[model samples]
Target chain A: MPSAAGPLKTTALTRLFRDMGARMVDFAGWELPVQFSSVLEEHQAVRTAAGLFDVSHMGEVEVRGRAALEVVQKLTSNDVSRLGPGQAQYTALTTDKGTFVDDIIVYRRDEDDFLAPIRSFHFIETAVGGTKCIVARTGYTGEDGFEIYAPPGDALDLFSALVREGSPHGLLPCGLGARDTLRLEARLLLYGNDLDETTTVLEAGLDSIVKLGKGPFIGSEALTREKERGPLRRLMGFEMIDAGIPRHGYPIRVEGAETGAVTSGTFGPTVKKSIGLAYFPSRAAGVGTRFSVGIRGRDAQAVIVPTPFYRRAH
Target chain B: MSKGNGIYPEDLKYTKEHEWLAVNGGVGTVGITHYAQSELGDIVYVELPAAGSPVVAGEEFGTVESVKAVSEIFAPVSGEVLEVNTALATSPETINKDPYGDGWLLKLKLADSKELDALMTAAEYRKYIEEEAN
Candidate 1:
């Protein structure tokens, strides 16, 4: 196998994954397991039983000092004042254009500190190689889970300890394949694939997190204007009515005309259907709005449906 | 033909794409190899071409979608599809559990028997996979 361009970084549990015969793929710049056994198996495990995930590839940024909450509130789209210590909220780091810098989970550690779980698009200065760490109740997978942020040297021990403790609860070390499917089933947007710098928070179907009235933030002006104008396209969920699986970048067509495109698509293991998220014109964005997805060269029938395709009973 | 790793059947003709053809007289039964199903993780959906559809060797006949990805199943030999295993629509995991038996994809009436000569035997296919793996 040809090596990855740069030296592929290994997570704390990389050796354990290799020993378990995990199929590894380079994600971002980190060598991570795509699956250990099967995506369906791991996905079902998370839905029914608990499944451990080594999401150490995700970056951790800490904002601390007396003005920590102010800094975070100014940068993120969500209201930081609402988060109590030990609570975490899904939020987006936005640009001046009201588009996403990255979608992140902000965990309120204390009055002076907050931990943000961000994708590896770029690293913030404070948290890199920092000694301070915190455990937060947050995860991309729509499960009751906690993410632990620690120094690089401490990651492996923490991961190993989690595996050891969680083994009895049926926590198999999950991988990116299961992670992607799980997040998709939960209607969670992935940064690069679903939400990019060009797409505004409202268009990405994340208006609930944009707390526009919470006082001025980086993107407040544009977001307020976009809110008043109404978004042109809205992100929505759809299920395939035809045999084919809808994949990313497949054109979304309405009445034989291209209307939008799929951002994230996969066979949802838990839901037992091929489901996807896509941007559609506002007129066709309602639930049950019928459409077709261009799968390969043929049009497979699809329809806009309610989101979070699968939710736990609790 | 020879079996390797006790998975691939020695009687089957194999393609580099990992499909196997079991020829009997003029008709052939086709399915993916154990290695293919194992590599694909969980098979959640199988889209088979309708019966009577014409297929050409080395061309896509249908698709097998796992939770992780959708993979095209290529025809190993040119033929007309006579039957599709509809049982897969409800239980696609059969491909992972028994890819050679209950997981068989289709039966085809061979258009030209000479096409089988181009396929690899089980032993050759195993060697090909081993070489590719390295």
Candidate 2:
């Protein structure tokens, strides 16, 4: 629990992070490790070998009933009917207006049981002192990984077990800083930074998962209409050509005219350049389109580039 | 080769912003302290001002960017920039690898030599950071 101005809430691995000399920061009301060794080192560790992360702050919701699949199908954009037990699918809970409620990963445990990963709030009841627990192969980073759900009391033990098991593979304990850079290099969309309630799935370039031909679900009608009408704005990737680092909320301009604002921006470790995502008018959102980003009161030259900036060799 | 916590050089002056100034014959070499680089975590970019730029004491002169965030670097003493470390342009990780040596950011020709007296001695800086941690 967090007070008004006190310290943020901690996960089970918080003490372990401190013991390892991690630098902590308040993220989404949780006191999480931003880095232990260094962001660059941890990021390279994940790319070349493997890095472990304490993502216990992510929320879990268990839906168990005869209508479990129906409830999930009604709420998410992906085709839930295609998911068999023990499988997981990336999805988004959309509003009636075809905008995001939240992006999530749904794990179908059984015909009547499903687990959805959210931003906050842990579903520890299903993990501890319960009959069944489902571990799913899912991650926000564009690497192969698994997210484990366990009871709050069991979190420490689980984390320790993972550390012990993964030690031989040169697994280092990673933190949020490495996580952000790795995901950004992969061009994954962050919820608050990339998608919001007012931003439609089509506009966010997530049309593959929006199966319109499937039977109706929440926001299906609006999404269908959107499919017919096309999106007004599109999220695009950009790399800085001139010297300057673009930051979130920086103005994106075209020929001295303000066009859009950067949604997320950072110096990508893998890419070895400053990269970012921003909304551009559909007409100007083509690959190689030149523009400028406002960085430190100066217009830095930039150009739209293809996404998934650094894809791992599969 | 230097000693003292294996990071902070005992003879250098430090700023509250975590910058260090090694003054030699009224010309000071400026760089971020070991604490700054450790806190920043794998610096990916260092934005430096051009040579001959006038830098005022306690004012932001440049920025140091890590993967997670960007931080402004403040000048420890009033001076004119003599040279900027161009090596950092292609290899910013030098700040993390050798913050005190190869990572030195800039060389400044001091405008007021006495300004160096206002900066904290290494012992005072160590104490100051310890207090801040508490």
Candidate 3:
């Protein structure tokens, strides 16, 4: 259901959000818009032209004090020195033995603010779990953009301002449904969908984020060990040919033997077919390699393709 | 996105899968229905059948993927993929705005004119939506 402006006086942001036919959902105790128009309309708008989303519900906290940058870089896997102002990067908040604490987009704005997709404690989620330093946002969307970090109260206002300014161009208000399809098409891993506490980064096919030879990071020892020892399982993207769409936890069989399970699957708008991401043995992760996705009782033909299911025209 | 002023034309016969066929000669010109496009919302991508590809009745000819969902464009009747709306690659929303006209997904030559009677009339299709809803 959707909420009309109540308690708080009506404002432009409130009215605009309501006018878009937004399905309001309570996320982390704050009111957030889930979908507007339809999940399909918003999702396609973002992929084709531009879709603006208000992520004001996301909270931001600071960890700056000079040691801020180092504390963060050591705590995260990526080299954060490159982030200056508008630039941002993707890094993980990890545990003592290479377990994932959270996946954070580290933004080095006026100060460092790491936006955790799933609402959680900003610093304690990363640092207290065995972080060497602080973190912030870098690259998201694979498009030209950077995330600005501020407290929820401030973020709500700023996001409203951004929509006003960005909408004059081609930016139309988008919702969470668009966000999910957008990232999945890019092969970007949403923590819960593709990564979890027990799932290590190496198994997620995130060597791009892990620097095995870089200076000491929190999970360096175990991560580097996994790198040297070789990863046991790896992530792969596949397209369904004969089988029904493989959803979360759908099993994968390699020549009648269980190989891995699907992490996520859905109709890929850009690919025009049902595509999904899953983890399988490293040897079976090659592109074009065939596998079977067990749906209910019958199995479907699924072949490994590249990580991202689609590539948009630049 | 604007399908001009007219989208659902009166002269065309519609298939349950949302395709409309207008027969003039030995060939039937096919397109998506206005109702079909509206149901699809914003179309981000489309797959066109190759020219002259033989199609069968009740079989999938191609697919149309909106921002939210995807569905196969089933052959309204047995035919061949005569021609496709090439403009769809640049403006997929035409399917949403003028599915029966500019957004016509593809055209085909009827394998049998008898198949035409098997389709629903405009009034029948409208009543069909009502029945499906109830």
lDDT of each: 0.84, 0.84, 0.69
Per-residue lDDT of candidate 2, residues A1-314 (tens digit): 25577878888888877777677788888888888777888888888888889888878898998899888888989998887666677888999988999888877664454346522212212352332455655666778766666666777777777678777888888988889888888888899999999899989999987988778888999999989988888999999999877888999998778988999888887778889999998889999999999888878899999998888887
lDDT of 1 by residue, A1-314 (tens): 23557678887778878887788887887888998877777888888887878887777788888999899999999998997665677889999999999998876664454346533221122332334455555667888765656776777666677678877887877889999999999998899989999899999988889998799999999999999989988989999888778889999998778987899999887887889999888887899988999888888898888989988687
* Error in Å for residue A113 of model 2: 13
DockQ values, each candidate? 0.54, 0.52, 0.13
Lowest summed-lDDT stretch of 10 residues in model 2 chain B? Answer: B1-10
Model no. 1, DockQ: 0.54
The fnat score for candidate 1 comes to 0.75
For model 3, residues A1-314, the per-residue Cα lDDT tens digits are 23354333322244456655565554444455656666666666666666666654444556688799889878888778876553456778777667688887776545444544422212211231232233222323434333343443344455566567666765667666667677777787877778887778888877778875668888889898888888888888999987255667889998889987888776665666778898888887789889899865668898988767766576
**Model 3 scores what on Cα lDDT?**
0.69
What TM-score, to 2 decimal places, does chain A of model 3 have? Answer: 0.77
lDDT of 1 at A38: 70
Compute the lDDT of residue A314 as modeled in candidate 2. Answer: 72
Runs of candidate 2 exceeding 4 Å displacement: A1-7, A111-133, B1-6
Worst lDDT window (10 residues) for model 2 chain A? A119-128
Q: After TM-score superposition, what is the CA distance of residue A250 in candidate 2 from its true location, in Å?
A: 1.8
